[model samples]
Target: MPDWKTTYAHFLDTAKTAYTANEQRGDLLVQGELALAKVTVDVASNDITNIEREEELTLYFQMKQLLNILRAIYNDQFDMQPEKEDALVAAVLYFVSPFDAIPDDAPLGLFDDAQVIDFVHEQLASDIDRFHHEM
Candidate 1:
């Protein structure tokens, strides 16, 4: 796998994967983006050094861009499946909470995202019962 920069660039460059993934559920794109956003937040909250301002700033910018992409994907996907929109939104919010296995101020900033993404992917792939349960 390439570095995070390359991987990030690749993901930012296209919507094809999301489009294809959403064909069945029609909301996979939004769910994916929501999942990404939640994961990004998890990563961001784990900054350990107050002195490494540059790194934090870079991450913040990346987070902003990722958030925009997620909003777009979510909005588009949400329009297609209004029935489960509420549930999807709830799940995204659930993951966005300031709670994770690691403290937000840990040295490994992006660690939480990996775990969160795995969970999000699982949830998004499964039924809506879990989402509704959160409500």
Candidate 2:
């Protein structure tokens, strides 16, 4: 298998491009909702322990924040532009996706998900802060 770092970099680049290009698509909200649902299920199913075992408490908190951001967006509480919405949705999709830089079943598989969540949080920092403040 390829080095995880390299694979993760590639996934990030590809995801950014795809999400940015499709930012104006009509079905972006639907896609985001579906991805959020999957992530929520995973969260409810004790998947969070993976991160806890990995000792990435910061990432664990970021994941919860990311989920809240998505939930706000889905609930129409956040008035984001189409492009921003698309980017946010793409990030969620990346986190929920099983076939990522490292397969989710692999050892420490959630490391990639945590990385994605961290990246997304950084990218959407202002929006996240605003959402939290407004809530």
Candidate 3:
């Protein structure tokens, strides 16, 4: 397995580039999120026995939470620091790329995504808690 840190840095760079492209990046964020959901559903419905059901469910929950936060920020319904917003978007952009650290076809591929989301979740813990409370 390669170092996830290097892969994560690459994701961050990709995200920054896409984010500043003068497009409707918020729309891109939503599309990226929906893609992740569809992929997860496809993986879940398959009969791959080695999958850890509990962990996958937990990852799905985190993905939903991140989407909610990003939506709230873009909709002007929630307040978060600028730095945290960058981290959140970077994590979401990981999904938009068809290429993964491990291809999505692998039974455990989403775990790489899980790693990014988990790290971002921790990074934004306070904001997430506040978002839950205030919004």
Off by over 4 Å in 2: 1-54
lDDT of every predicted structure (CA atoms)? 0.40, 0.62, 0.73
TM-score for each of the candidates: 0.30, 0.60, 0.83
Candidate 1 pairs with clashing backbones? 46-104
Q: 50-127, model 2: which lDDT tens digit per residue?
A: 655444556556766766666666566767766566556655666556777777777776667677677667878898
Taking every candidate in turn, the Cα RMSD to the unseen true structure, in Å, is 13.0, 5.0, 2.5
Instruction: Quote model 1's TM-score.
Output: 0.30
**Candidate that beats the other on lDDT, 1 or 2, i.e. the better one:** 2
Highest TM-score against the true fold, candidate: 3
Give the clash count for model 3. Answer: 0
Candidate 1 per-residue C-alpha lDDT over 1-135 given as tens digits, one digit per residue, 9 for 90 to 100: 244334333332333333234342335434545555544454466444554444444444433333343454444632324323333333333234333444444555444433433433344443333323432
* Superior by TM-score: candidate 1 or candidate 2: 2
Tens-place lDDT per residue, model 3, 14-95, is: 6666675425567766686777677577557755454566667767788788888887877779877766776878878775
Residue pairs whose backbone atoms clash in candidate 3:
none
